[model samples]
Target: MSLKAQLQDEQKAAMRAKDKQRLGTLRMLMAAVKQREVDERIELDDEQVLAIIVKQVKQRKDAAEQFIAAERQDLADVELAEITVLEEFLPKPLSEEEISELISAAISQSGAAGMQDMGKVMGVLKPQVQGRADMGAISAAVRKQLA
Candidate 1:
């Protein structure tokens, strides 16, 4: 089954089991995806779904940091739970070594000698690495290699 169908089925199961946390997270995810589809007038592929999941996880992480700064463990716990729920849909992330190698290859392929060509390196690498590794980390690797 497609991811959407699987999420719907799992959402139903969560509801049946009275898994309130899972149910709420799944509903929030579905709403975000549906909103994107409606606003962009385009159907989402699996990659797009994964992108949404990554964005949600990043948001939760940011919220968790803020909660921590404010000494709100309870709120941070909720965001962390949401992150766990969102992560279930993402592919396993690439390791740092693997990410570094890919960035190095992209830099070489693009002939990026220095920081001036960071965008060129990223432009060459983005699609290949998308949904597999975090872009922020990849950019750092590229910059480190160039430096």
Candidate 2:
């Protein structure tokens, strides 16, 4: 099933199970997806939906970090819970070894000999790693390889 359909099914299940937290999180995600579709005037494919989920997870992580720094454990916990729910829709994460290999391959494919070609390397890596790896980490790995 498409990711969006899977999300809808999960949302229905959450509703039937009376899983308030899960239901709320799914609703929030659906709203974000709908908002993006309306804004862009195009139906989002699975990759686009995954991108949205990834962005939401990143936002929640940043919020959780800020909440922790502010000593708001309750808020941070909520953010963390939301992150857990969002991550259910993401692909399995790549291992560090796998990510390193991907970076090496991307660099070679792009002929990225130096930091100046970081964009080329990232362009080659992003589609393959999206939703499966953290882009920031991937960029850092690419940077290290280039350097």
Best by lDDT: 2
Writing each residue's lDDT as its tens digit, candidate 2 over 1-147 gives: 999999999999999999999999999999999999999999999999999999999999999999999999999999999999999899999999999999999889999889999999999999999999988888888898899
Kindly provide the TM-score of model 2 when superposed on the true structure, using C-alpha atoms.
0.97
Summing lDDT over every window of 10 consecutive residues in candidate 2, give the lowest-scoring window: 134-143
What's model 2's lDDT at 89? 92
Assess candidate 1 and give its TM-score to the true structure.
0.91
Candidate 2 ranges beyond 4 A from true positions: none
User: Which pairs clash in the backbone of model 1?
Assistant: none
TM-score of each: 0.91, 0.97
Q: Per-residue alpha-carbon lDDT of model 1 for 32-140, expressed as tens digits? A: 9999999999999877887788888889999999999999999999999998887887777788888878887888899888999999999998877776787887887
Note each model's CA RMSD in angstroms: 1.6, 0.8
lDDT of each: 0.87, 0.95
